[model samples]
Target: MKVSSMDESGKYDKANERLAQVKEEVGKVMVGQEDVIEQVLISILCDGNILLESNPGMGKTKMISTISKVLGLEFSRIQNTPDLMPSDITGTHIVDESADTTDFVFQKGPIFANMILADEINRATPKTQSALLEAMQEKQVTVGNNSYSLDDPFFLMATQNPIEQEGTYPLPEAQRDRFMMKVELDYPSLEEENKIVDRFTSELDFEPELENVISRSSLIRLQEFTRKVPIANDLREKAVNIASATREKEELDYGASPRASMNIVLASKARALIEGRNHVSEKDIKEVAKPVLRHRIGLSFQAEKQGMNEDKIIDQIIEQQ
Candidate 1:
């Protein structure tokens, strides 16, 4: 079903309302880090993957799991480790000895689901990581000579431990580029923490139930609607200028690529729709810029010595913009 801005005006407005309801449904389970939740949704709206970095017990897994349930999407999780293999990540081919079969059979891995949680993803070797990465980028898996397309609306949300570096393989630039956003989750405030403790330490100690907010067809339609959201010429230039500045500055050794510019504009459009608007604005660009570009840029040795990083550099660039 093709949905366009010209097709129907109410369709866009209705989708925006549904997207807002998704936020409310997810909030029932997630405590703090509203920004993190928003960014994850923004990534989903853009049909992109995200790398979530945070400390232990920050509710990273729980949040995503709850979100999957709320969205009524098929969810699968793989705890990535050094011993993991590519065949283990994607589906593997096995010999079928049962029945009258004497041929090789393919067993689909967890990657076939609508949403995937690659837990501790950095622990896996590059080869194993690529299995997931390829599926993320191509939306399909190849084993032997056959290829299998993943379910529609496939989404990958991976988690990484920030403090643990031992035995962990850092994702290369190309692999990192596959992720459109790197969302860093933070600890909750005092009041939020108090609520967390009270909520979890209760006598019941039961998980909250999340409703399936929308259908798969609705999600696809919304993704289409996101692309059709209009952006002013000035806002588009601002996005480009910020992305270009990343490469032009000498303070950083590496900078965001052209993909970053594309993601920023796309993410900005998604954010505008989430805000119940049909068009992109400068505020939308700034709101989505940091998380969208932070992981794409690289920092220089001098910047490292001065305690400058992607976040700081992005801030500087945005300030200049």
Candidate 2:
């Protein structure tokens, strides 16, 4: 889909302006992982949740922290542990002695921040894992008997360690579907690594000031624009076909849910806006297919025993479709 440079509505120009500012801010601290950054932006712009899988020391936390700083938002980090409780994440109520009565006042946890970094999410127990579902889906946190809406432009960037499978309670299917994308961060190039080491070991821990270019109102406008991005009938049908193939294919056990199709289309639209286009394209759909659908689809026992990863299965589905 080739969009004209001059959009009649002029909305494309606004999206591009904000995108440029975000990219410029992200560039200050992050060395590589451009695709990862783009995917994260897609989720944020679409008001969707993200689940990031990466080996330790890949700077997943740093990337999210940079995003928060650039946006001039409050950032919070939570380290998920096996013994962590739901209250630890969602916060519990406390009694006020001055009031002389017990009122369920929500204290709010790390999840209440504008930008939250959930480090080692899978390490937390399933009970604790369920605590995030409401916040991620409804943009609100419920503690005790009261609910509190999170800040505007709320984003959850959760990281999970893939190397450690033991003693980890994998996120259930229902909870996993709430995430918009599951991005995998890989090792940086030798040159990038060299730069990182030199910059970090030196006394000059370079921290760049990310200018606040987009305001709360502008972000809401961009999200509305994302919804208005055109998705042709044929492209929408193609997205469904690709999702269905994952379930019907001989190599796979289960297929992606209806939510997968919804996320793909929405994410594709966001990607188009990020690229300065007003309409979604097949290329955008294909680019985000794996991350959006990988966790949503279940694998067969044989496929799992054979060590077939979700990425490989997603590739086959996209190719066949």
Candidate 3:
């Protein structure tokens, strides 16, 4: 429901409180990276996939698994490697020999769960990587003749090690566009690292008992509410213009598509909701623009030689808008 009246405003406040609880619960197991956590939540609220890039041992898997537990969603993990096959992600039909006769039964893969963590996704082959396209876009998998629908509230978070490129196959542009955001996980600060060391090393098996902050139905309702958050006309126009300017810039060889524009606005709306605001703001758009557009745009050789990165280029585009 839209938050147009005072009654609806109270509902919005209550949802925000619950979402805050979700963050707090996640913080128990996770350290810093507050922005990263917020972006992941925003992507979930939009019902979109995520591409996480970071160095090894950055707690990407731990962060995702913890969020799944706190949200009361089923979580599955797939470790992608060079030998990983398409059937490994999407289930294959197996022969089941029962008492009466032998029959083919479909075994669902990890993709059937509510939250999936695809670790080291770039390590998989191109063919294997392409297998995720149908599921990410359509939320279903086609084996031979029959298609199986995935569970509701399905979310995929694929992580790739940015420092390694030896045996990795970079994701194609089409597949990258399917992700709503490409969140970069950076190294924690000195204090945050100290806290991480104490939190994990102090206990033998430091597994914090995280309570279910948001139930399944509550999460689904929050996803619906995220779309109802309002944005001003000027801010919406600015979001569009920021995306459009990417195409016109000479520093970039390729620009983002209309999907980038749509994601920018949608992500801004979700960010507003997460920040306990009923209306989208310019700061929200600016904050979400980098992650939304970073992976979608390509830089020219000159820009690369000039030591310019996607985030830097995106910042320039935002300023122009």
Which one is best on lDDT?
3
Better of 1 and 3 by TM-score: 3
Clashes per candidate (backbone, < 3 Å) = 0, 0, 0
Which residue pairs in candidate 3 have backbone atoms (N, alpha carbon, C) closer than 3 angstroms, thus clashing?
A: none
Residue range 93-162, candidate 3, lDDT tens digits: 9999874889999998888899999999999999999999998999998998999999888999999988
lDDT of 1 by residue, 186-253 (tens): 88999999998888888576577777898888788788889989999988999999999999888877
Among all windows of 10 consecutive residues in model 3, the one with the lowest summed lDDT is 1-10
TM-score versus the correct structure, for each prediction: 0.94, 0.93, 0.97
Candidate 1, poorest ten consecutive residues by summed lDDT: 1-10
* Candidate 3 overall lDDT versus native: 0.92
List runs of model 1 lying over 4 Å from the truth. Answer: 1-9, 203-205
lDDT (CA) for every model shown? 0.87, 0.85, 0.92
Clashing pairs in 1: none
Query: Once model 1 is optimally superposed onto the true structure by TM-score, how far is the C-alpha of residue 143 displaced, in angstroms?
Result: 1.4
